[model samples]
Target: MELTVERGDLTTVAADAIVNAANSSLLGGGGVDGAIHAAAGPRLLAACRELRRTTLPDGLPVGDAVATPGFDLPAPWVIHTVGPNRHAGETDPGLLASCFARSLDVAADLRARTVAFPAVSAGVYGWAADDVARAAVAAVRSWDDENPAALDEVRFVLFNDVLLEAFDAALVAA
Candidate 1:
């Protein structure tokens, strides 16, 4: 598997699947979640609502992931993962790592070769960019080690230079 980091809008990044740093509700919220939902249009919300109404009546759990069709976006699929909120006392790095690993698992289930991810838990969620980067890269590397041929490329589509720098440093150090 190949790993890369690029500064760009996650919503516009071209990939077979994109990972949304979604809230537990899987409903539209701030940051990456809002952007992806907005880019994916109304169908995405409808799909999410259906998931909530049936499968996820309570809400998605932190560090867990689920997939939905990317209705109006470039990617055909959206893998939604709930990142742990630091403000809510969810400071476990393992939980943060699970977000990435589970998203990759979901992508592999969809048979997607290329996947794009945002800086999960970094924005508004209160995790530092460097911490998020390290946990993300480590999880992806560990996943790749286990599923060597499952994916072709995994791109960290960061929204800012700070995140790009953090992920790049993590990649180099890894």
Candidate 2:
């Protein structure tokens, strides 16, 4: 599989699937999650509510992932995962890594050829961009190694120069 880091909006990525850095509630909040909900339209929220009413009444736990239609967004699928909250003392790197690994697992199950991801937990969750980059690169590269050619491409769609540099540097270091 090919892995590339690009500076772009996650919602605009035309990959087969995009990962949402969502809150546990999955109802939609600020940053990437809110952007995704807005772009996907109200049907996305309705789907999330249905999920809550049925299988996910307790909310999605950090590091786990679930899929939903992309709705009005560019991609066909959205894999939502809750990132560990640093302020809440959930700073474990394993949890952060699980967010990447589980998202890939979900994408593979969906038979998606390409997937786009944001910097999970690096923003409002307050994880350091550099550390989050390292963990994300490690998790994705490890997954790629274990399941060669499982995905055609994996794009880390960074929002700005700093995030791009962090992920790019991690890829280089790998």
Candidate 3:
């Protein structure tokens, strides 16, 4: 697996799959979730509406990710993942790390070599960007060690230069 850090729009990554930092409901909301939905158009919402009330682990709160055509974005599929809420402490870090791990798991299962991730839990969820970057890089590194060929490339798409700097520092330290 290859690791990369970048500042880009998750809605515009031209990869096999892009992960959406979703709410527990899996319904469309603001930040990355809203951007993905808007880019994928109405069909994405229609598809997600069919999957209401999907369940996962108690603390994790992720739903079974559903694939949709990236109607407007460059990616072929969009993967929706619900991360833990803010104020969750180290417990939140665990759950957020799981979000990246599970998203990559799904991508590998689908034979996707490349995937893109937004800064999960850093938007409306209020997770510290630095912490999220550390947890995400750790999770990806661990996952890569276990499944060396599972991912050929992974990009951390930061929306702003500050976040880019944060991820860059974290990656260097990782």
Candidate 4:
């Protein structure tokens, strides 16, 4: 897979799928999750609600991911994954790493050629930007290596120049 780092709003990306840094509820919350739900319109919420009523009755587990229709967003599919919250005492780096890997697994299963991702757990979840960058890059790269030709592209959509730079460096280091 080709890895690219770009500083922009993930909501506007036109990839095959976009990964949301979601709360376990998958209903909708702040940051990237809220922005995606807003851009994707009410139909997105309806899909999530259906998911809650069915497959994810107890809510999505941290580090795992599920796919839903993107509705109004440019992408056809939205993959939601809950990152472990450090403030809530779920501080395992492996869990954070799994968020990236598992999202790719879900995307590959959906036959997504391109997938966009936010810096999961780096915002209100209290993870340092650089640390999140390292974990994201490492996991994504590892997944690509383990499953060659499974995904055509993976974009890390960052919000600012600082995070963009950090992810770029992490990609290089990986």
RMSD of 1: 0.5
**Over 4 Å off, model 1:** none
Full candidate order by TM-score, most accurate first: 1, 2, 4, 3
Q: In order, what lDDT does every prediction score? A: 0.96, 0.96, 0.80, 0.95
Can you tell me which runs of candidate 2 are displaced by over 4 Å? none
lDDT digits (tens) for residues 31-74 of candidate 2: 99999999999999999999889999999999999999999999
Instruction: Mark the 10 consecutive residues where model 2 has the least summed lDDT.
Output: 1-10
lDDT of prediction 1:
0.96
lDDT string for model 4 (1-174, tens) is: 789999999999999999999999999999999999999999999999999999999999999999999999999999999999999999999999999999999999999999999999998999988999999999998999999999999999999887898898898888
- Structure candidate 3, residue pairs in collision: none
Per-residue C-alpha lDDT of model 3 across residues 80-115, encoded as one tens digit per residue = 787766754434477888888888888887888899
Worst 10 residues of 4 by lDDT: 160-169
| Residue pairs in collision within model 2 | none
Q: 63-121 in candidate 1: lDDT tens per residue?
A: 99999999999999999999999999999999999999999999999999999999999
**How many clashes does the backbone of model 3 have?**
0
Lowest lDDT 10-residue stretch of candidate 1: 5-14
